[model samples]
Target chain A: MTAFIGEFNCKLDEKGRLSIPSKLRAQFPEAVGNTLVVNRGFEKCLVLYTKEDWLDETAKLNAVDDFMSPDIRRFKRIFTNGANLVQIDGAQRILVPKKLLEYAELTAEVILVANGNKIELWDQAIYESELNVDAAEMSQLAQLFHQQRNQG
Target chain B: MTAFIGEFNCKLDEKGRLSIPSKLRAQFPEAVGNTLVVNRGFEKCLVLYTKEDWLDETAKLNAVDDFMSPDIRRFKRIFTNGANLVQIDGAQRILVPKKLLEYAELTAEVILVANGNKIELWDQAIYESELNVDAAEMSQLAQLFHQQRNQG
Candidate 1:
């Protein structure tokens, strides 16, 4: 499997539409004609996926036994209920809903798109302010990867 | 901002190539034009990211204090050296490095792509064997989202 990497700084238009990077756009011919799912990302950003992948994920969420506990109900309410299904327009832009935009604290100006298996959308100011890369953290992360590799 | 909120079953071709589902392609435009950084994910899977995102994350990893402790070194080695940058082809397919395939215990048959802010690539058999979205887990995950939303 190919890993998606890199960070991109771009602008979110007035309507909260982000222009999918051209290179990134080339990755999804199939998604061009169908509905795409967008929702809150684990990190302080947004995530987008295909309907198939979304369904697969939702199935697991649905399988959660909410009747078993309050935690289950809360989980369904947060992750499941918060999810939104969106369609990509011909311009290769997905309209960021006001609620979701607000959730991510996006102000419709500049946003940061960080590359991952799924793309992360972030407010430019927040992303920049939150960006704290020091030498110490790098080493720690590297070691974590090494240990996992060895264990695997 | 959109979220990719689920898991998916996928396959890695004999050549270490995994097909980005057509529908999900929109989620990863970076894979179409730029290189990807494949690394060890938290769970038993490989993580894919765009170079930009990887760099941002690596910056965080790079921030680790190398002189702090032995454990830090391990993390640095794993996350830094253990990471592989793979290119996405015109077909939007990415080649998983041999070492990564082995590290993730992928046998070149089936794999799973769990979508979130980042994509987690897992061995299909292993993913199937281990994937269990019980009510408890779901609820816990949902609560986390809710908490994050409130905080954000």
Candidate 2:
């Protein structure tokens, strides 16, 4: 099982097409084919998942008793709301949906942060500004997390 | 398929056992039995997932190609680092693992916030201090979210 990792810099052309770095492109499982699923992330970014992973996630939601809770219904709707299925072209480029682009405020310059199972597409500037914690802070966070784990 | 909803206030007895309010307990799907999965949340809180949902989520992670990326390795480790599988007792109480309790800084009082597929357990004081946005602010945040959704 290969998972996405490492950060990649890329460009979103005016026409909304993004060229996937060959290295990153190679990370996509062969079984995933050429299809990708684009959706709004929990944060202010777009989430890119292989169609295989996307289906697995949606299956869980489908199993939920939607009729039992409006909260669940709303969650399902929002989770899949702006989701789009895209294909990689001959140039290894995938066109992001206009709505998703706007949702993430993606512009000419963007970045892809590999988050284990999914890739987070962000406006480079926004990602840098919002997620710019110093190494000290990150270490502290990691330490706290590990401490709890060890203690537990 | 009934899902948990609404907020519930509960006490963590000295023994580290948390009694689930009957209302919230009623929301548990009968098929889920008494098993629950407790894990660290992205935030400084604990996430409670039914056995069914937990399996579904873990299945996706299990599908990842662990050898291809170190990020995935660290992620898998952290995500499941302090996870515990507990069960509801005859009195509807679940004993939180000591490590999890310390991780979330849980003392006597805690709040369970139903978040669609999972419930978030937070130390009452921390939750109130960190998530206590004014109604106006919440409305503003909601408006921003909806605007993006509508625009997209």
Candidate 3:
């Protein structure tokens, strides 16, 4: 499958609805229907997942021994709290829930980034600053990732 | 795109190459080109991502402050170390690398599971056991996920 790629800019309507950008629209299969799951993500970004992906993600959380530690329980609680099912209308738009919008600090201007398995919706300026990190830092990241794989 | 769904069993050749089942193959876009990334996944499964997805995943790693703490560093290391690129041959087969194959304990029979952004390769028997979690646990999981989202 073509991996979800590129960055998309979307305008959240006054009622908090935003159309799924064509870029992402192209990645979806027609048969999966129009359901989606939106949740609060790291930083000030929100995460969007096809419903199937949401269940898959929940399994990951299920595997985590949340009761093992207070930190893990807290993290899981916050993460799960943000998840909500949404429907993409005939025009391929979704109305971002108010609390979720607030959780991610979303505004009229938003940037959507495809992260392979999921999409990240970010406030425009926040997205830009995120991309502004030093190139050296980015380079180091690749190196670090490599170090882990090589050992395995 | 349709959230990739379905399970197909495959026979691993002596060389460890497995063909992409027609079911999952149907999910891929024809024009994206054939490169893919395979990596170790949680719970003894192998995760497959299109090369495009790999780059998207790198962005997630980039966001983590590598020097922030030992836990994140260790987690990232283990996660990243198992990643490797595999090219799909004209016949639509991918050769699992030795290290990755070992990581997932793959053998003669394998199960391919579609989990939205990625496809998981699992040992046939292992996959069944994973699906064997009690109904109550599964029910409770759905409840937990909703409990978190409901308050939001």
Candidate 4:
């Protein structure tokens, strides 16, 4: 299993292809090869999951008893709503699906947040303004975390 | 790999223990056994990853060239800032760490959004009020997704 970390400043070409940072690329497991799954994130960003991880996700959806719940049906539909399976070309770049590009509002500049199992693609401005936590808040969150951790 | 789907309504017992929905629990890969990793999410919620999946995440973090960027260092600190490891007991329940529970504001009622490789635990009221997309938005989102998927 491969879990990703770090944030990289990257760019999308005029053709809408974004180059994967080599350091991030190096983290891809052999099982994932060149295939990647791109989808809308819970937030207004995009998520990149390795092909192997994507398969596991699909298997989970497949196990759902959809008929038993409309929420499940809707979730299955929307969770995979604009998902695209892309391959890294020889140049280590992937064509951002136009619709997804529009959805995430990606332009020339983008940021790749290599979160655990998924990579988040965000417009640089949106990422900085929306996702960046202030130092005070982070300190509080960290303190709360450590408090519970020590208790356990 | 195991992917999860659907949202399940649940409750936190007096002891702050949450029972994993049997359906969702069934989705856990055998390799995961009873171990789980709980951490603060990018959003104001808690994220649960299978132990196997968590290990993969750590592996990615280990590969990072931290000395190259201060951004990476800060991200690493906040990303796993409040991470905790817990186990599902014989009753299939895991104790939500006290501080994490308070951080997420999870009280009696809770909602579990089993997304792909991880599960997001949110306060039911907060989830409904903050995360629920109205019908019009869902339709628009669906249209955009289908258009992009078809283009490929």
Q: lDDT winner among the candidates?
A: 4
Residue-wise C-alpha lDDT for candidate 1, range A69-106, written one tens digit per residue: 99888867787665787867888777878898888888
Whole-model lDDT values for every prediction: 0.64, 0.78, 0.75, 0.80
Q: By DockQ, highest first, what's the ranking?
A: 1, 3, 4, 2
Local accuracy of candidate 1 as per-residue lDDT tens digits, B59-86: 6654544435545534443344335567
In terms of docking quality, model 1 is: incorrect
Give me the iRMSD of candidate 1, please: 9.2
Residue-wise C-alpha lDDT for candidate 2, range B9-113, written one tens digit per residue: 999999999999998988887888998878877677999998678766666655554443444444444454445567799999999877678879999999999
- What TM-score applies to chain A of candidate 2? 0.87
Q: Which regions of candidate 1 are displaced past 4 Å?
A: A1-6, A29-32, A108-117, A138-152, B1-152
Ranked candidates, highest lDDT first: 4, 2, 3, 1
Listed in order, each prediction's TM-score against the native is 0.46, 0.48, 0.50, 0.49
Number of clashing residue pairs in every model? Answer: 47, 3, 9, 2
Tens-digit lDDT string for candidate 4 (B81-106): 45666779999999887868988999
Docking quality band of candidate 2, CAPRI definitions: incorrect
Using TM-score as the measure, the top candidate is 3
Q: How big is the positional error of residue A32 in model 3, measured in Å on the Cα after superposition?
A: 2.5
* Each candidate's DockQ: 0.11, 0.02, 0.02, 0.02
DockQ top scorer: 1
Q: What CAPRI class is candidate 4?
A: incorrect
Model 3 achieves a DockQ score of 0.02
Query: What is the overall TM-score of model 2 with all chains considered together?
Result: 0.48
